[model samples]
Target: LLYALLHLSGFEDVSMEEVKNFRQWGSKTPGHPEFGHTAGVDATTGPLGQGISTATGFAQAERFLAAKYNREGFNIFDHYTYVICGDGDLMEGVSSEAASYAGLQKLDK
Candidate 1:
């Protein structure tokens, strides 16, 4: 469903055909997202909370880079990290810890 939505929303990296072949060998779609394996996949999320944790890490890195390089009127590293998580992800200790750190670091944006 997520892939379908992304494709419908004009995310060229995702395709309905790939969604159909999901979990098949040599297919762009996999059981879990693999960053380098697929063009639009930013992180590998085989584990329940891995996506949330990885998103937090990406947000933190963006924040750090922005702080170091952003100018008063030029926000070079300005971007948003969007994460889709479920109750299972919230149940994980790693997700809790990563969420806490993201909150503390003001990475909500």
Candidate 2:
């Protein structure tokens, strides 16, 4: 999936060669993505529940910006934050904390 996303994004460092060399020494693509090292990744993420925690903050920021900027017919900051989690991710305490925070804040977006 990362290879496909890199392919679609056409990120400069993620060449076809880079895709083939993914996870190898010195390759731009690592086993886990490194944000800022890559152009397309929004946040540094891994297999754990970190993605949920990061995404909660990201979505809250988006919501705040949307509320602050968007006028009746002049929408500016509009996009849905998407997260896909596995059973392991959900089992993590950070994920539960993030979920509870989202619920408490009513972060519907």
Per-residue lDDT tens digits for candidate 2, residues 2-102, read: 65576777778778888888889988788677888766767777769998998899889989999899999988988877776678999999999999999
How displaced is residue 69 in candidate 2, in Å? 1.7
TM-score of each: 0.86, 0.80
RMSD of 2: 2.2
lDDT for model 1: 0.83
Candidate 1 on 10-100: residue-level lDDT in tens?
7776788888888899877777777787776777787788888899889989989998999999999999999888899889999999998
lDDT of each: 0.83, 0.83
lDDT of 2 at 109: 81
* Poorest lDDT segment (10 consecutive residues) of candidate 2: 1-10
Clashes of each: 0, 0
Candidate 2 off by > 4 Å? none
The 10 consecutive residues of candidate 1 with the worst lDDT sum are 1-10
TM-score result, candidate 1: 0.86
